[model samples]
Target: MIESGFAKNLTGQNLSSHLGPVSGKGDVRVGFFWTKVQLRTKNPALNGKIVNRLCIAKQPIGDRYTVSHAYISQQDAARLYPQEFGIFTQYETAPANGTPLSDIPGVSRSEIGLLELHAITCVEDLLSLHPDQVSQIGMAASRVYKVAKGWQDKKDENEEILTAADVQAKAEEAIKAMEERLARLEANNTRLQAENDVLRHSASGHPAQSAAVTTAVQAAAAPGDDAPYEFPDDDGFMAGGDVVTGNDDLSDMPDPMKD
Candidate 1:
């Protein structure tokens, strides 16, 4: 029924300037389009009002096809070029990646069906329609468009919030890992300093007392007693049961008497 009045409004125009020169294979696009038309009202005040109407065009075959382009009504295009029309319909109805019309708040199934009649299949498609083209859906156009736009804006904001939250979480994890590493390093340094103090005291103190204390401290500090063994070269006792001093000479004291 919409296509019945298309003939009354169809007007000729040059598409070559916009579509570029037609190829030898007669390749030209066919789809619904919005075109501006002056109002036919008798009132001078209303006569200047302009409106956009949806139109379909197809490139005809043979001699007329040689003309490069032809504008036709949707019904006529479907009747004359069924294959091209079928392809157009298939592409329009195909699954798209954008948010579906039904997903938006306040957009009912009946309203979605009405929008589909005008070739708007998704939120993005609906958003792209001109305000005048959108008004063709009658009184509900403004409400539907507002809701779809609002839904899209809200979705973008939520995504941004989530992205920021993820970044903060990763940063917190990195800081926690660094803190753990510093704590372990501090503990290792404290233990090393304690071992060094014990070793220094052993090297400077009396040999007999120091040896006993050193062995006890080392054994407690290191479970495996992994510290290196160190024996003083100047220690007095030797293999023959003689006491040798620093000069490597025997002691002058006489041996204890025997029976």
Candidate 2:
């Protein structure tokens, strides 16, 4: 059975310095890592190789946490920290926000997974990184640099499209706001029209034509000649004997003999 190994810190902290210097003193293999002895390793250059920081593959695990590797050395083995020599490493790595490799022009899932193993997942993260730092993740440093450069170029080319998308989103929001305002105006207009109709019905002198018709009906119901009453066509009513029939004496009657 494979032993998952006992977890001390469980966190991927390197302890080579704490155990004592592993690099300077020995018959130890010249280019060998002390990792085989099971002492946790740091970014290899932690002691003094600050310039070699790029060679140290640090996976950005969120804003926090890193699954660091710990290698054992002959010095560590000789010191007898562990019963024997063995490498202790974090098996499971945590996740962070990085661009998908698939979105990149030529990156495959495997290469994407490789980058993730070190915590560089997104295009932004990948591009933001220094070429030297990217080199630590493995394969060939040149190829990684090439891929990152290519993706950066792709991003540059598509910048216009991104800008257009932002513009479109803002325009759509503005149109939606305008439509809502128009709808409110329409609703208010309809309500006002209804109120106007109610006021017309409740008014004392509404429908002038209808009131005229009603007056005509009442006049028709009253006893009256079909012909409309006419005023004196001439102003000679006073001179005509038939015009004023009121207090005329017997002499008021018209006589055909006189004509």
Candidate 3:
């Protein structure tokens, strides 16, 4: 039995008086109050008896109140074990964008009975259904499944599902092609650089060669200066030697014209 009370204070209220008298067959007695009261049980049958205590408080100043209560049961107390469950709502058909049935193109949302199939709640389940089974219900099951699985007949870049290996292979191929191209470009650059260096060296030497030729011509033009000439050593005669000023005693050739 449960009993509750509210008052300014516990001074005159008899706590035991509220409990009344126990009948002949009642095994346990129960009572609660804001103030403390003492009771005892010496019976072996009542030993280790469990009691639940509760205190409820209400608000609003003058209306503020507190009530104490206890629960007593004859059965042995047991711990409650909680289990989790999911609630699946059943519709006449599947929900739109919830489950697809076929892979056909241009299938309208209105035409597709998305809320019809039983035991098919997700797109994955829809994709796993057989075409014939879906056809029995007068729907394009295969097409719907394909669409749900993101497989379309047309070439859609977004719909392609490449495996890791396939992607890796394609990447490797692209890398190889790029490397080959880079190698060709590097080779071409190397060849061009070599040609440029050769051209630069030749251009640099041309000025020096021209200056030397001018100096030789000027020396030859000066009187008493050596003539610009060349002679084969094996030919005893001064076959190719010519004096610019024509004042040469062959043995008096200037050092510039010698050897």
lDDT, candidate 2, equals 0.55
Top candidate by lDDT: 1
Worst 10 residues of 2 by lDDT: 47-56
Q: 101-145, model 2: which lDDT tens digit per residue?
A: 556666676787677667775667777778778777776434755
lDDT of each: 0.67, 0.55, 0.47
In model 3, how large is the Cα lDDT of residue 144?
A: 59
- Evaluation by TM-score, superior candidate among 1 and 3: 1
**Model 1, range 95-193, lDDT digits (tens) per residue?**
444566777987888788787777776799989887777877876766798888888889787997887876776666667767888999999999999
Writing each residue's lDDT as its tens digit, candidate 3 over 1-259 gives 8787875887876555444442234222222212122223443233333332222222222221323344422121122111100111121222333323333456655435552335554455655577676666555555555565565333245434545555666566667767888999999999999999999888787998878888878777783424535555787775565556644554454555676
Rank list by lDDT: 1, 2, 3
- The regions of model 2 sitting more than 4 angstroms off are 1-113, 130-148, 157-165, 199-259
